[model samples]
Target: MTNVLILGAHGQIARLATSQLLQETDHHLRLFLRQPERLTITDQAREEVVDGDVLDSAALTKAMAGIDVVYANLGNAKIEAQAKSVVAAMTKAGVKRLIWISTLGIYDEVPGAFGQWNHQMLDGGYLETYAAAAKVIEQSGLAYTIIRPAWLSNADTVSYELTQKGEPFKGTEVSRKSIADLVVKLINDPQQHIGESLGVNQPGTDGDKPSFY
Candidate 1:
């Protein structure tokens, strides 16, 4: 069982991923979040809840100590700083593997219908922000897997396909559960995705067309 640390544990994707990890896997989890009370975890004995913000380097350093891997599902805003702190903390703690959640079009790789819509929804360097973060991770000397999911959906069901580097994004929307599952998969076997950025999305879907009127 891997000793995994999940940053941004209160976020939607993080919550779902935690649920799956708890129910399906034997791995131990340390949930790092700003508000521990808001977490819906039932197995108190199985999870170590660290109430702190990612921006707090000291707290993060403390939380990351002695962990095997880190799964980051941080939001886009302030991602650069947050990632930097995580890297520093992990480095200090001697944790190496990092699984980071990003969005499609971070490299203008979004393809099909979804890519077009994502471009419109996320304007003004939203793509650039994540791309920059990925760039940092790539160069941080850490074994990392960057997952860029298509426009996220709250649907209860999840189905997805994985696209590796150089492949254009395909598909439409992805359930938060699906994203969570992917994270778990990585945690289960880090060797499969070390140092690679992959894309996930619903198949046969396209971007939401904009109205010119």
Candidate 2:
């Protein structure tokens, strides 16, 4: 069984991925979050919740012990700093595989009017920091697959498509469940999309903005 470290485990997508991992795979999970008490353990035998900040390199390094894969579902204005910490901790611990959850437009890959709307929505600080963070991961020399998801929804269905880094992003939005499904798929095959950045969106969701918006 592979040991997986999930940083920011309290987040919605992380929680979904955690549950799916437990139910679908026999991998052991180390759920790292600031408020550990907020997470309810579904399988104590395969899940260990750790209270620590990703920015704390020492704590991250400690949690990296025996970890085979690092799936980071973290965000915020200090994302660049967090990326640095994760890279450093993983490097020090000798772990190489990383699955990072980033957002669309990080590379301005979105096309047409939707791209402009996306910029209007996320340009200020969010996109800037996430792009910087992705840069850190790409240059870290780790076996990493960066997932840049389109606008997220709470839809229960798992329907999505992927576009490579240079390709214009497809569709308008994707469900959180879809992203979680992709994460589990990568964890099961850690080498699948190494050194590539993917843009994920729901099939037929092409529009100027998400249907919900």
Candidate 3:
């Protein structure tokens, strides 16, 4: 069974992905979170939780040991530093695959009215930080898949179409569940999405704008 490390394990999307992974795959889960006490999972059969800040490389390396794939659901702010730490830890631990979650408008990939609003809402240091993190992953010489979802929602179900880099954002909003599902799929089939940065959103819906606005 594949051994996967999940960063920010207590976050909503990460929690959903953890649940799905436990149900759908035989993979072993290593959960890296700042606050491990917040996670309330009854099943302890195939899961290990490590409490540590994302910026702590030694801690991350300790948690990442023997891990084959890493799912990064870290938030913004010091995301660039966190990504650097993760890359360093993964390299030291020989973990070659990473599925990282970024957001729309990081590279101005979204277009038209929604794109404009996205820029307005997510602009400034955070966007730059995410972009820097993306660049680090792109140049890390490791197999990586960057999943950038549009404005996120707490919808209950999973359903969305993913567009690769250079395509317009599919829609203004995608359920967190959908993003989680996609992350899980990528984890299960790492070879298909390696070195690709994808944009995900609910499909076939027009005239709806980015949820940030």
Q: Each candidate: what lDDT?
A: 0.84, 0.96, 0.86
**Poorly placed runs, candidate 3 (over 4 Å):** 211-213
Reference-based lDDT, residue 165, model 3: 85
Q: Which of the numbered candidates is closest to the native, going by highest lDDT?
A: 2
TM-score of each: 0.92, 0.99, 0.95
Please report how far candidate 3 places residue 160 from its true position, in Å: 0.8
Q: Of the candidates numbered 2 and 3, which has the greater lDDT value?
A: 2
The local lDDT score (0 to 100) that residue 178 gets in candidate 1 is 88
Best by TM-score: 2
lDDT of 1 at 156: 83
Worst 10 residues of 1 by lDDT: 204-213
Better of 1 and 2 by TM-score: 2
lDDT of 2 by residue, 136-155 (tens): 99999999999999999999
Error of 3 at 75 (Å): 1.0
Off by over 4 Å in 1: 112-114, 207-213
Pairs with steric clashes in candidate 3? none
